[model samples]
Target: MAKSNNNNRNMSVEEAGKKGGEKVSEKYNQEHFEEIGQKGGEKTSEKYNQKHFEDIGQKGGETTSQKKDKEFYQEIGKKGGETTSEKHGEEFYEDIGQKGGNRSRGGRSNR
Candidate 1:
């Protein structure tokens, strides 16, 4: 019964694509990714401007926040911080802090 239920959840091509995209990316070389990414970015920029980007980003953020609770975000944030700390070391935080400080030099700015 359980095996049949699990088998019922067979993947479609799109689902397979989404699941294996990371594996495919891992198999490829960096230059291939960079080239394809640049092409995709160019196409996206051609189709959508600043306002379009802002609208999609806003919608995505809102939908994600609604779907996931505070604890979910906190866990991901902690994991991301740990990964960054491992890869870049403490100096990475100092550089980022200075960059962030430079960006917010003036009074409170509106997003």
Candidate 2:
């Protein structure tokens, strides 16, 4: 049993490579990899944005407790816009269309 465990722990390059290939084939099936990758990437970006927004919210709350006014809100909005532009490039704003105070659930069809 000890010898069997030792043998299991040591793998030849060909055996290890074959195992790796099997894992790639099994986990990244041709029909699902692209969809899985896209979902994972979107989730990652959403989490990042949520964390960033939460931090901004905390800072805004702290500042409001000290001195709150329309100017304070405007300043936060301006800073957020500037930071968004800087991170995503100036063309980012053009990608989003204006809404007449009614936005869909993220571009889903009405039907």
Candidate 3:
């Protein structure tokens, strides 16, 4: 009976040791998981911030380009208008003068 009691006590101690080891392992695993999750979150945030800044920069460039395009079109339109005005003014005066001179010459000749 004494030997049997000693064996039972040893079994209980072994079971307790296994339970304690399992608890420690579980705690370590949980802490490791938390640390990994925190690192991943930080990396993701950094990437997002970099991408957001790039997008803002691209938008600013696009706006500047749009303004430049508008100015270019306005300058072209102004130049075109000036050229047309000059051409039409000269042609109109010359055409009317020639017509009057031809008519006067024809009347004198007929007389």
Best by lDDT: 1
Give a tens-digit lDDT track for model 2, residues 7-81. 467666777677778988886667687888899998977778777868888999888768888887898899998
Model 1 off-target regions past 4 Å? 1-34, 95-111
Which structure among the candidates has the greatest TM-score?
1
Put down candidate 1 lDDT per residue, 5-106, tens digits, no spaces: 355876667767766798897899999989999999999999989999999999999999999998999999999988877899778888777778767886
The TM-score of predicted model 1 comes to: 0.53
Q: What Cα-based lDDT does every candidate model obtain?
A: 0.82, 0.71, 0.75
- True lDDT of residue 81, candidate 1: 84
**Clash pairs of candidate 2?**
none
RMSD of each: 8.5, 14.4, 31.1
Candidates sorted on lDDT, descending: 1, 3, 2
**Candidate 3 or 2, higher lDDT:** 3
Worst 10 residues of 1 by lDDT: 1-10
Better of 2 and 3 by TM-score: 2
Which of candidates 1 and 3 is the stronger one according to lDDT?
1
Winner of 1 and 3 under TM-score: 1
Estimate the TM-score of every prediction. Answer: 0.53, 0.29, 0.21
| C-alpha lDDT of residue 89 in model 1 | 72
Per-candidate clashes, comma-separated: 0, 0, 0
Residue clash pairs of candidate 1 = none
